[model samples]
Target: MSKKGKKPADSPATERPRPIASTVAPPPARSAPVTSASSPPTAPPKPTQAAPPDALIWFDKRVKITLGVFVGIFLLFVLFKWHYISLPAWNEILPDGGPAKRGLVAGTPKRIRMDDYAVGAPWILSNANTGFKTENEAVGGLKTPLLTLPVKHPIIIFKIGYWGFMFLDVERGYSWMYNSSPLILLLGTFLFFLLVSKNQYWLSLTGALTLFLSSGTVRWSFIPSSMIGYCGLAFVGAVYLLRSTNPKVYIPVAFGLIWIIVSFAITLYPPYQIPMAYLFIFLLIGYVLNERKLVFPPKSVLVKLISLAGALLVAGFVAYLFKSDVDETVKAVSGTVYPGKRSETGGTGFIANWYSEYYSWFFDDQQFPKGWLNICELSHYLNFVPVVSPLAIALFAFTRRIDWMLVGAMAFVVLMWLWMEVGYPEAIAKATLMSMVPTRRGQIPMGVGGIVLLFLYLAALRNVSLSDLKQAIPVWFTPVAIVGIVAFVVYTAYVNINDAEGMLRTDQTFMPVLFFILMNGLLLFSLNIRYRMALFCGGIILFLLPNLKANPLSKGLTPLTENLVYQNVKTLVDKDPDARWIVNGSQFVTYMVTATGAKQITGVKYIPNRKQIFSVLDPTMKRDSAYNRYAHVTFQTYINGAQGDTTILAQQYEDGYVIAGDPCSPKFKKLNVKYMLYDHAPQIPYEVRCMKKAVELGSMTIYERID
Candidate 1:
């Protein structure tokens, strides 16, 4: 034993104090036996300090100014090109009359109405009373809801106009929102990057451009739900990534972002947003592990949990507001339509061929008769960028330097896509949440994941060394997998005889070749990482350019409001303000007439009545056909051609258009078809038919019906 007064080397005075909670007391000192010729006292450990904020790395002053200038220029350019600044008359905004083609309508001068007309028609035409109204068969009405339900997604196009263009008149507001939706995407990307990157202007700019220029974005640019859904996903990612050493700053921001996430989630379109939701969830988990070791210090945990609870409550309330409508829409869309079931004899289910044609993005001259009419929404449109970023992610994973949360998020998306394609059992798909989203929409999440991983890969590379590269390179399985991808693509192409039969377009043959080149570029970079980023950047730019220019930016000046037929129809509606009408020959004509303050028996809507609205126009259509299943007016034309159907042939209605049949009919009088608008004088079965020629405006002929 040591002398009574002598203290031990490992005694309290010589020992390091453990970090303690404020409520806990320190232990009382204790004496210990002395050791031989003494070792030096050990030093106390330094208290841990959080790392400097990572978001600061991107906040360069010059980058902000440059991005601002570029954005201002872009906005000004679009404004001038689209004639939005000076403002055209509402009548000149969008064309109303044009010739119809098979599988095409002349809504706009060019046949670009897949979005400009089809989805946007209701908004531009202001079909306020178009949804499920009373069952009035006198006007060719039905007992069932005319619309599917929860009209929010379809009406979002109109809402954008209603809210965003408050400065302009009603018609122009819709026209503006329809044409300038790309700006919304750009704005969302900027806000997202600003929050996540801490105003890292360059990164924000790149990401915004990447997302905005993506083929899916370009294809869905006119559809507000698509862009709005993307904005929600971006908001989620931004909020998830926010963190700071200072709790005061980050904690409040975190709470606020949580609320934002809840709002965004409630507004989500399952097709695009579900995958992104899962992706951000993984990213959030990863961020926690990387930054906080999955343990937010006790105080932080309490605040985050409270915030989450509050957000969920708010989201629940919001969802309840539209829950009924959404449920009905879900049921209707899942029925026998393009993306729906087929006949019992087993023709291809409406959207099954489109799903099978997923590989069009890989082919140069690929065609998708049933896919997004814009031709840019194919999964592979981003070319090698999607393929290569995942490789980089895998490389980092192999070396154990990867942030697995990010990896897990991306891996889940790939798995979900595969799950859908291979026809896994529903139990498995549902368990994995793959069945919740449409198979076609998987591209959106995969595209987002690819971009996120690209940013992650770049960040990882910044601190990596040659030794790290050496360590990561030996993971030969990644390269082997890439080879396997190439082989599978070639074998599939050969087996399908896509080469000789030209079933697959050969125009884009360079894409698969480009994938190899990108892979080679990555290999080249392992030797030296400093300069090859430009090559990859160039490759990305090349992939983006085609889709970016899919529609003319200058066309924004030429609105969809203008047309010879709209003016004529408006005049007719002005004469008899109380009557409802129907148009024959063209859906665009119907939309134009609707825009002129007329009620339509049918027009373009996201979910048209499924219980055979076409049967109202042609009684024979009560029997099921493509028209009833598709619930589109254009399907009537096809059915008319296919079956030589004369049920509607020569049938005359007062809204405008007389078939070769008898004009004086009790059905026409009961329907209150006051005026018939047609391209030519129709054959009157008898002179006693109380139909008088009203006016002839060029190719359009108006006939007033007096029973």
Candidate 2:
């Protein structure tokens, strides 16, 4: 019906109010153009993403591939050298040698005894005798609480077996187990340079030489902890280098590295583990932050991080099967042993020295006649020149020419050193949930970081010209160099003059100090000339020269398997396989007896069990004295022959060792010490008659118990 007043259906009002006249007009329709039907329909433009940066292309593809192949070959060479290639050298070292060839030097008791129990001997012995259980005889008859855990670096143990088995014939009593540690380090150093030096083969070679030949690396060459640390660092370098190649490969490579690093870390004690974990985290974070300018991490990066965290958690759980072992070690070490007691310079000595010694930088050789300082920790300074890396880092940072990655590395070095040397870092560590961390282990990172920083500094200097040096030194380079040289010279002169007049017989201080000064001077000159390559080569030379003289075989191990004392002890052990024995001689004698499969009344390396000590010692044994300090059921033994004297006999009783002169004593019987070897025998018929004679070898007289 047509009704405007009633809004008829045909009217404008009824026709949806003229479509409400849109305020925002619709897009104008295109006019129909006179085009042919043959024209193709236009396609829509495709969405695109920003291309990844190529700023990381430091090496040519050909060079990278060649070096990678070389690395593979080198690795193979090392493995072959460890196995088949060792034959020529073996034959040359000992003519007509069968399986029984000369092995590497017997190092300190920690290396000879503790390391063998931890990873070396157990692996060799287990493989040698199929029925031999490592768990039952780890570090002697008494079990090491830590070794019971799954975290004993089985990867390292397996690696040792794979590469060391051919040459290390346990049946023939070959003791070249520790020799592989140095070789591993050498391989690791090469890998580190290959990854980090950006295909600069010369730099890589120089760096490898500098690191492998460093006194610290040499001195602690026998320790798997140090070796593991180096390997972890090499993998870290690989991860850093590979992340830039392709994102598709980055995730898997990074994760793979995490697995390897964590595996290496978990196999050993905490000293190496904590630092490596920290380095991985730091490098990952720094890389992500530096690569992506975005403040917040992307979802992909977040996912990778979460995955890493989960993997690390799983690894940690697997490495330490039970947390109780770690806890027990913490509890024990915090009590009255060498770890807990006041050292020579007070407070746990150099081993657990919470405070760094002021003179640590000066000590290179700690061997008897050649060393100025006898401190073990100070050996880390071998061939290390005093150039103040922090100062250089600070200068670069202020100039804003420094890469953040290197800055982070240097920061780690400084942080680790401070953690080891100063009180504050350890205080913070203890205050946090990481209270169980042995702060001494921080030195691993310190050593590694220092080495890395040295390389980075040299790498940075490689590009600097004389003009750049002139501009960078800020008009004070020459005067500063002169002053530094003169100051060091004057300091050395004063030290030498004072030392010559002191109680020391021969003045060994001047030569080292002079060498140090000369090295610093040469480095400073190289800085002036921008000859970093020369300086690095000189550094290698400086590090290699002093430590070239091999570590003298640990006393009493001139010939490791065929020593006279070891043979005598082995005979007695072979007779009564079940009976325990005590050696009234040096720690080396104890080591020899233990190596021969004899169950020692007291352990050769570690502290003995407290309960065992209490069972054998007098009831009046003081809790705070040396007797208590030297007592444990595990590894504590007489350090040397201290028979006849009351205190020494008391110490022997406390340590669970038999009193040499009194084999018939109640304590000896209680401990079941069925045999004794007296190196410094007291000529008394009463004492001699108490035990049945079992032949004398050299200064030692073997005896069988006759109650």
Candidate 3:
């Protein structure tokens, strides 16, 4: 039936619609059958074949599964068994014959990392024997907990190393956790860049390796490295959960976030943690804003926000479970004279140090300038982002396109620089929460931000072609930018050279030229999309080469674990687990004793026990200046025995102190000293009433208190 104002097909009133006329007249119809007999008929064009499917497409499920299987096998069978730990530094202290007999598989162990070898690694092993309790009796007794843990603490109850304990026995668990710290950093950094760059493979990889091999990371591989890694994981998991739409992924991502957050917090190194926290907050805000539509869609925004809040709440709850322990720790640490109550007004850092990475390769602990800086503190990442940032800003201005991530990273870096190189008012520092971060520690986040800015700058230029750049940027800008970058590089080098004051070697003088060339090349390559990945690859090589030796590739912990001295000490401690001992002559021996699970009064003290421990040594509190702070305790024989003093204490440095006293003194007995390990024979005659030689092994002797 016909509808209103419409006609049916059979309606007589329906007229045939005429085609719309063309504006130009059509050509006259060709005459029919005009082809000559000799002319061959044109063959119908062959049907076009579909273009071959892209061979370099992203990995499919099958390929991904195969690769995952291989990675798992490699991790379980190979990586976990070997370690890059600097435990071989013991070879120097205990000299195992010669180079051939040394326990190291390859690379020279850094003696400069005595903290890792002498304190951190030993305490980790000691915890295994103590049922993984937070209070390690080996060092500062129940008052000072082991700040560095490879296993779950009884009170803390959570550590990233719990996975190692779940899979391996105590010894192997220590090895696994030690080896995996760097892996965590590498993987987390890789994942962070991958997510931020939208899965730009080479760029992500370069960023990850650059940070992994960075001097600060390798130098402080235990706590700071793990902290950075966990922070990265937390950021990555947060981003994933925020952008996720699947309910199935929500629970897993939330759980991962909790783990990451807790692990990061427990690292407990505020100097690194505070700065990194500031950097991540900026990045997270910028990321959410940049991906607002995807991260906070109208349909799922509430659910995502609730999931994030829930994850954070659960993490906070877990931390609250150990509130008493956390509070006690925080109180003790905050009360310390060295780090506790320490506030910085900034403007203490040297601008030359930013460029010091170039000369840092030649840093010899022995040859390092006196009272200038230590090796660990001198370490920094080689970052040219600050030098190249002006050009990036100009490009962004000319193109009228701003990458919020780049802006966020740049802003963080600028803030850190201002705090480190420019003094701020105390009120401003407190308001900005920069008081907790020292000028040296600010380098951690600043270096990290610089690298992030560098990669983000490259990512921002990904879609901008060279032709587009030529059109968008002025003719004079290129030469001006080039001159500016060179000037910056030269000025930076000049400052560093003058600050170094002839410390740089003859060959190291070319580092600035190389840096300048690389910076110019990076700028040039970034302008063209084709060379972007190439530039990243070059960067990876540049980062990996010099920093490869930052850490040594050592095999097992046999140097300490299997040595006769450790065996003897372990056997002795096993017999009298409650007896408190002392190590005389060397601090390294004290660390060895701590590792043997023996209670030692003279070892690394995480938290000073002023009331019980220090009071016994200094009853009158006259030596509070020496023993009040956290210190690595070392003992030297009292040369002036005629004075009849039981003990004489002096602060050797901020983190160390020396006590010169007779081992048989009444003060040592009051501290519950049962035995003493001496690196040399006692210069004073052993008092039969108080002490006697227990045994002699090689050049070392152990004295047993016989009160």
Candidate 4:
């Protein structure tokens, strides 16, 4: 045979070539390399298998499902068996050793949130039994039934999750009260995962927990917290409808969009809602621009547009159904003297904005310094965005690339900070409709934006390599970022130190310092891809530290409802369902009376009743500014007025009023005041003779009108 045609001695000449495994394959196994006789033939090296994926990556793939299950179980347990409601705080007003004293299963209830314990909760429970209506007969007079559906007021019928439970049964709906905070947290986390993190489960959970557990959400865990979740849901729904090609997703997304819009509109808290709307608008624009290809494919454009338009039309129709009720409420609220026509140009509460998050941990049980704001007012999100902004700027500047989401988030936050720290012009404020957003209320958007910015920056960091970072960013950037962060922290500390009046103790500074260092450290680690998991885990830990004990884990509503005084009031109202009541003591008594289904003239007023209620007390309009606004009316007898006269003493507080009057007055009679709750006996004999005591427990006394 010719040498060129000859086969190797050990080869099977008839063996056919193996089929290629892929379009590209390793060069057909090379013939064994020629070996010298001196070197024994070595076994051909084994093909290398790919190293197993890192364990953490495996965990990451399933972590979302695992964490989701955990959250679901925790939610169900708390909703049915235990809750974190602050109803136990009502114990402070109950007589010592009274039959209905609220008991705690875990943490202490926060008295600082009387609005929740003494007012909002009672109103919700009362409304549950009385039927959810725009007008709550339990409060104000029947003709002037208090507007119970506005602001943070929780009318179960309008509340999303709670309303569903009411369909099952009223008790189930009532029990669902505890579900609000946890449900908000879950919704925020779930929606943020889809909207901001691109389904990055761990990052979304961390951000949501941090944001919702912050002082603002924990203390004002009603409208503000709900707004965050609803906004997130709306954004996610909009994005899904915009990008989805499947017909199955369209219906659910559309329904969710409608639900979120209606719920958000009904919330009626413009302070938080307006700023949040501005932030989301910025986010939506940036998101669309960034994901233009996915969100705006020409082939799917018609379907997407139709789906969105249909959803919005339905939502508009639903809103139109409530137009009459909403208009009446708007008119009543606008006519009030306090929050009515209240406009702001920002540049207020700067110190609180900067340092309140750090200092608020200490003030949860006590009043914040200056006594101008309570714990809830002082609460703010522990946002690391300010510290991380420099790093983000440097990254984008060096790489010559921009992340629109980060830019959008940073823009919103920066604008809010400017509005808060340096007053904005009145013209700009009015034009943007941000005048409705007081600087103090601006924290909601700023805090929410900070969290979004943090996660977006983290998502962006994943696309960057170490080589690109090293080549683009100078080594000195780390120290500069550290120094800037430290300076900001120190400035906040200094501001509080100067103004705290000994309230910010040295020991209290430890947590802020530790958290500052840890948070910045995690942001610094974001520069290196290898430490990404560490950064996420560490960030979650730091965020969780301050909020671990924010609320108590208690069971049931007995703490506020089962007491002897409440039962007695319930009995009295059961006999005379049409009777009206007036409380002559603490505002707590007023709300408690309202909780028993008794018509309370002095309960928290949702809107001023100028013509029927307030005008009767101040007919001459002498104190129109005082009685012409929302207030919790309290009565105190004074000898100055005629035997049956009343005078509005002061309306200095937005939510309260001091009225020096005789409960036996014709004004009270005209209002149909049939019962009086007192913390003390009347000192005036004439006032004493007007009513006879009917129920007494400890210091609280209930009297029936005798006139």
Candidate 5:
């Protein structure tokens, strides 16, 4: 293939699993003597690949370790989610009964439309002709969807015991599917470990478990982050397929690439399609440069062009099915206030004006590219997913020779850095112009970078060249690696000190830091487990025990949360036929609908009508205008001009009542929200003010619509 100017990858031999029989020849024999005009070249016999007795032992041990790790992980999750020990069914924040009222499990347009309030109802519940419906620009003509199947249901279903759940699988919780990606990402880690490591099974499982349950993976699992997950899924396939020295590997890799592209249509980040395309180009270019194999193989650029074009065609066809209004989609997505202020200034009044213009994009020395931007402005940008500072991590490749995972990792680094490059202050104008979040939304690259570092470190540790370590006699590098691991852990811990507050604030931040600490700690300790299992286990697990309890699913929760759960009970019922009323003291919406035979909106989304709401529960603020009450709500934005209609929308007795926070912040005064419908506010500001307790239904408090 090389003699023909063909890429090594394009060679028919590059994609399949290499034969490993002892009698089989080594896949590459590039050292064969070249035939010249002056001399006859003797054909050297093929190099054998017979497995040594020790190789079988190594393989078996690796598999054993992998199984043990997998089982341990599964058990940990199962134990935490053993049974929902949550508090009694009380009112949930932004109480609403959406899709359940519409006879569905939530995530439907009926639910999302009301909850998100950012899009038109029709566009959200597209049930019309063709595939999915979408628009390229805010007001562009309707276009086809990008995915092959209607992306309406891009989740998976798992029947774990009696609890059947849908994830990324639209059939279940629509917007709640972040767990699926971790599983796929684990496969990539496993295959990578398979590529390195003397105790292959132990190495593969260790990396796989880390990737699978990585803090970032779990924290991001709740939202609609399937794009990252799907990409990860594809990355696994691509790495394995490309690394093989046989043809079978290429076929799947090609298909995997197509699948990766196809999945992008369903994401909020539509423009990312361009970068993803570039990623494919990146892979092809790498293969061509390294192995001198044309990335698309069949000896011609035409085939590659056709294949790529076909993928684009499929995407276009998918795009056509959308009938949604472009304005709605773009507004729903691009309307964030970066630095805490609107990117565009216009319209509205007073609080609305203030809200639309309040600024928070302050430049922090820590965030700046060397802390250059010190501007204070209100703009729409995104908070980055917490990951290690990518710059410090990129030093790996310069420090060592590269392999398959290493290459994929390098690509990941580029993409993640590209994400930061695309956003940050340096590229604000360009990113805002595109209506995309700062490059942080593309955190898959960060994840890939992590995987790369893990692999590089492990590869260095587990290399067979260190015969002393492989044979268990220990090597010179072992002590150095140990010291290196210790320093890395301590330095990372120091980096975390600055971030500890953020980590403490949310499970999202805490998990990543804790995992980094533990992973390094484990890697360090695992190498010398004989004398310190108790010490290492105690140190790491003790810190983890407190944090693990924070997961709502974990056992032995605090009684305060338990008692609160027992205090609130809300329900739906057709009781007292004349009223056919829906009443609740519980948190569950489904119970409300099932108990009361009335229509109720399920879930929460911003609505412009908040200013007109009249509260019936609170006596102290009954006369306050909805507009007056609304402005006091700290977390919300004014939907209409502060000058717009301040008149109360619903009379105290007519329309259904809404359940919300108390009169603590000026928000209640701004909106003139007439209701004080609770005994307590457990969340933030609302909790500050006391209210009359309704009824303790199973642990949740039920408030009343006061007069």
Candidate 6:
């Protein structure tokens, strides 16, 4: 402190600045302090921050470790799916029960040949086995990785059809491939949420698991028809397009438009008339601001009108093309009875009567009718399993776009119903039954509504909110959930029908009622993530345990002969591409030949046997089952549909390349047939004989077609 007795703190070099002169009196300055050499160096200026608690690296390391744990979980998810869930589901949906269930397991590959075979009428009839028959030929038959953007239209259609067709694997045939569109939409939407959400991992996982466990989704896997899938996909496309970034863009819009047009064509089939789904895209699009006008100067209002008109005109032209094509097809089929009419006489007569009863099913009734003939309707065929419509319908309010769309759908359905009942049909109820479009399937659309609501509910939650008190739920959603619960419970009970313990239960006589009950329960209202996981696991269990348990109703049956008609056709085709064989069975052969590589013969009916005649003939025709009478009628039918001269069965086979008669059947002996051709029958010797350990190649016995 030193110079002139001033302290070091008062020195000019060390002193702080004085306050402003006008505002306050100036402080005096002092001289610097003198030190010997230098005072022990003052400690360096103190750091500004307090020492961090322990090591900051710990927090960072924890974050990294947590991240690593999540990665591990994701890997685990993939592993579970690959090892225990998806792979098995794929296996199940692929062959014996799913994919490779045919008799040609050891067959040699023939070159893939493509063609639009001109099949005029149903031939090679064999409608007996409806179980898990659709083989997803496009996926299974065509050697391709993806279906989109194929060069050929038929191939494209086949590819698109395959995805939808193979998605569901049932006991017999596949549901419409169109349903895949909706499933695809659901998956896309789910993936979008998974990608954007804060808790993406769980959401992503849930999305993946969704396809594996969804019973409603899986139940439709193997339906032979593709119509339902298409209609549902139309809805899916509309929903997806409207929600997309560029609603006016051509890609999705084009797909949507084209699909709608395609949908209309397929809807001609009586079973596919789900008319309630009127395309309400215009209504939805009306809400979107046309970004096109923002960039370009606005055109006159009349230009908009003209554009709409032009678009309509183009659409009309396309419609005309489709109409022309269908007209040509219908011209060929003009004399034939529709599928429903055929069902009545061939085997499904009750189904025909039911559809013919009142044009449409009365779903609002306290109890919807369950008729054995209506094989396609869940109410009848799956009587023991039950039909759960309420569970899906109650979610109408909670679904985002669904409630409004459902309203439109309901209106459309009602309009269709009215048309059937009072407008379209003139002969009281009879005309309605015969001519009106099908529109009573409230289950699928309603089920979709429920699923959308569930998704919304799931998406709206935070991990904390869901974990904590229920206070965070939107006030409006609580009632929705309550309604859903009520609906779900109601439908569950409605569909929860009891099996009549009789010869019915005799086949699998010993299985507990609980097992069946649990299986049914799993199918109904079980779409949660965990439940889906369980389903995947359970499905795996079923595949692994191929128990040869028998149902007593089977009565210890055995096979008498093996009808290799399909195999026989394949052989004939292979022997000579031009060789034609006449099939006199049911509707089963058409699908089998189509799946395998055989062309349809004209001898069969699309809806075969007795059904065809009943459908076309006046109702006054008396029922007769005598073989000679049937033989005469069949012979005439063959002449009319194809060859002017009918080929006599016994005489044509003299060339030795033909087979005739049921080898072990009394009918064969009665017909006085010299040679035998094998066919499938769940009778005493046939079942046992057909099951002989056999290896099949491309040359595997398909069917023994009698010449």
Question: Which whole-number lDDT from 0 to 100 does residue 471 have in model 4?
Answer: 66
Model 6, 1-707: lDDT tens digits are 01222222212222232211101112344445555666775545422221121111112233335445544653443332211101111121212222321222222211110010111101101211111222111111111112111122232242443432233221111112223333343343333333222123343334333322332233233121234334434443443333333324324444554555454444344432333233233212321222223223432334334444555566566556545534533433333322222211011122222111111122211223354222223321111111223322433222222323223333443443344234443353243232333322333332333333232223322221222323333556545544544443444333323221121222232232333344334432223234442453354234222211100001000100022334444444455443323233322333334332332222222321222222222133332222111111111111222533222332122111111223333332233222211223323444223223222323222333232
Clashes of 4: 1
Candidate 3 contains a number of clashing pairs equal to 0
lDDT, model 5, position 355:
13
Give the higher-TM-score candidate: 5 or 6.
5
* Model 2 lDDT tens row, 568-607: 6667667776676766655445545555666565433243
Write down the lDDT that model 5 would get. Answer: 0.32
So what's the TM-score on candidate 5?
0.46
Task: Evaluate all candidate structures by whole-model CA lDDT and list the values in order.
Answer: 0.45, 0.45, 0.67, 0.65, 0.32, 0.29
When superposed on Cα atoms, how far off is each prediction in RMSD?
A: 12.0, 16.0, 11.0, 9.9, 15.0, 19.5
Off by over 4 Å in 5: 1-179, 188-201, 220-228, 236-256, 269-290, 293-315, 323-327, 335-448, 460-603, 606-707
Compared with the true structure, what per-residue lDDT tens digits does model 3 show for residues 372-445?
46767776677777555776677667667666666788888888888888968999888777787888777877
lDDT of 3: 0.67
Residue 34 Cα positional deviation in candidate 2, in Å, after optimal superposition: 46
Residues 264-292 of candidate 4 have per-residue lDDT tens digits of 76776788888887788888888777766
Collision count of model 6: 67
Candidate 6 wrong stretches, greater than 4 Å? 1-159, 162-217, 222-256, 259-322, 331-335, 340-376, 379-442, 453-571, 574-576, 583-604, 607-707
Pairwise TM-score winner, candidates 2 and 4? 4
User: What TM-score goes with each of the models?
Assistant: 0.67, 0.64, 0.84, 0.83, 0.46, 0.40
- Greater lDDT among 2 and 6 belongs to 2
